[model samples]
Target: MKARASPSIIRRSFILPVLLMLAFILPFMFLRVAYLVLESSTLCSSPLDCMRLRLFGGSDSSLIMKMERKVQSSRWRESIYWHLASHGVPKNLHCLHLKLAEEYAVNASARSSLPSPEYMSRLTDSSFDHVVLLTDNVLAASVVISSTVKNSGNPGKLVFHVVTDKKTYSPMHSWFAMNIVASAVVEVKGLHQYDWSHEVNIGVKEMLEIHRLIWSHKYKYMKGEDFEFLVDHERDLEFLSPRFISLLNHLRIYIPELFPDLNKIVFLDDDVVVQRDLSSLWHLDLNGKIVGAVVDSFCGDGCCPGRKYKDYFNFSDPVISADFRPDRCGWLYGMNVFDLEAWRKTNITRTYHRWLKFNLDSGLELWNPGTLPPALIAFDGLVHDIDPSWHVAGLGYRYPQVSLQTLKAAAVIHFSGPAKPWLEIGIPELRSLWTRHVNFSNKFFTKCRIEE
Candidate 1:
């Protein structure tokens, strides 16, 4: 221990420790260098700022702030993209329509798909369980018919009245004609087939212009605080989407006039799939209430947070505030059981027309776009709260929040939100439930590249 070590031995001993230290420090140094290189593009706005950031590592919250901005921008872009997609028909479905139209034009059997006179008579007989569906989609109509008939206890009693626009008439009729539902009677009628007054047409046209203006320039009407609600407002606007402003969407108000012989009917949106026997809905006593529907209050989840009257109507308007309570809860419309007999006694249609004119005259300030707002006003006291299990809605936007138990127990599941099941943007899990009812193996579907 007293002996002095040689210079070479001492140097070797020091070198080993130094090498270990360098090895440990190198990784951290490399990581820092990589971070700087990766973030070079956004290191700082100016040369001085970059130098200061590198030297002091101060005011570096800018990086995190920039990241946050990017995230927000991404979300906004996503919302806009979804809105655009929802408003248009999917390419595959458009292809299906074209192929079906071609088939209808040439194939004799395609034109003869309507049920015989004996079964066709049952449409107006009203003894059968009548379900009304208004849509221009051929695939959707097929799914609705297929699912309802498949789930019905008495399939023979189920009759579907499918209404479509003029453009979709040929394809819609051909589809039902070629692929007939054995148990159910499907009657496809076009808008042109219906006989209504020119006065009614003018009223709808005026409403259209008002709605178009409101939707086309939605942000123009927003107040300072309202911008905070832009996220929810965008979602609400889907209900009144431009895609749904067609004449068919307005036809719900005139249900009594449309089907005079039917005492009652189950109105189904094309976006819904029936999971249980709907015959029971026909038997439910509405107790003088014009419509039997599931209340949004019972949702108990995000799928359908209870909406109030104020959520739909403009309470700032004197007429709206005087007549409607801001806190009054709203019911859903997708799977409603309407007592047409009761509706006929009331001036509901006239009231609807009056409000439509009033809203147009007031410069579209009364409510948001879409048919639901006017409907909520028109059917104010006439909604009968049916069992929540009968109709489970919000499949389009909030499918994840809905539990398996609830969905399994539901008689009808509605994709009330913008993401309709047939669309590419539709959630995969929920889409499967709707697609299960679709006949993917059908020749027409295969020919048109329509797949699961």
Candidate 2:
């Protein structure tokens, strides 16, 4: 500096430093490029390899096999028998509850139906392997027991279960069952309990309670069990197929894992009945995918009605940075499956809870317990679209014949529409289907008698 270095010397000095920096960076850059190329080659070798990487974290053969085993041993494979009955079994109420019970048995061979009268003594004896009691408007513990006995061919391995609230049972009966039978009654007390603050919130409360019942059943009965598959049905369901047992068995053997992460579950709503054996749908390979939903509108141009609702909630789209798109397909609308393990591990439940809190805190009313948030959270970038035949909304407007034709092509039929067969505005087509498949005359009257 004192000598006022010559221009050439200064330039040379700067050039030397620049060259040295490049020399260091060039090697790192080369290594990065080489690694990327190697990784790309390894990952792109085959479809299975690529899928493995995307699903189980890598293309390592051992890892894939381990993941497959985990899937095979998943809790979703375990047999889940569901009963959705209310408090009082009315004679006229046989329409929905009895139909659902028959459908449940048709779906799962392992599942047995014990109506209330039969359930009382069986609960104390523990005669059945797995028992599910639907308690709502019915107080017929005897009917539940009898239904299970009648539906279940074997009862020695019985696991007594009940889904209801304290209101569903008389105080004396609740105390009696609790003290004598050692029965497990799952009631959603926290967020699921009935609240009369607002009428609009009632639907949300009911949906939440249903979800809670599913979760509680999972934790209590299916946590570590290894079995074929778990199925839940509402009291309003009808069975149109006789191959329900075979289909469930096929799913258990072929896929071996229904919900790998416990983050997902396939929910078949009761309104729809089966036309074909659902084995094909059960065998669908999720390839570690988190959610699979039947495409509601095949038109493909239709949009989700809930898109604008996202803005109202101040929520950001996790998939697209922009506002939530109504056209996005994986909304878990009618019948959906969940990956239970993944769900438990991720913020799914937390997200749902937060969303609920946000809605309640902001004094915003909601319907259906909000299926979108958990759907968004569990969507790991892939959602398989099943056939439309799987879910034909059974609103009376759609002719039952057309719906049945659709059902014939589908693995499962979801009665997602408003008009139910039990309701007055019945679809003559469904009634015809029921007459053809189920012994409606005998079973229908029997159900009525049992309920009465």
Model 1, global lDDT: 0.79
In candidate 1, stretches whose alpha carbon ends up further than 4 angstroms from where it belongs are 17-67, 217-240, 300-306, 398-400
Candidate 2 local lDDT, 1-452, one digit each (tens):
38798999999999999999999999997886566555545335444554546555674876566555555544332211211121123355544344544444454421322323545453434222333333332223333333233333343433434334444333213322322322332211111333434643553454355434333433443335444322332211211111121122112111102222122223433344445433333345666654556544533365431223342223443433354554354443444443444444454434444554544444333212234444454343555666665555434333333433445565444433334444444455554433243333444335554221
Q: Identify the leading candidate in terms of TM-score.
A: 1
lDDT of each: 0.79, 0.39
In lDDT terms, which candidate is top? 1
- Expressed as tens digits, the lDDT of each residue in 167-197 for candidate 1 is 9999999999888788788898888887877
Per-prediction TM-score: 0.88, 0.40
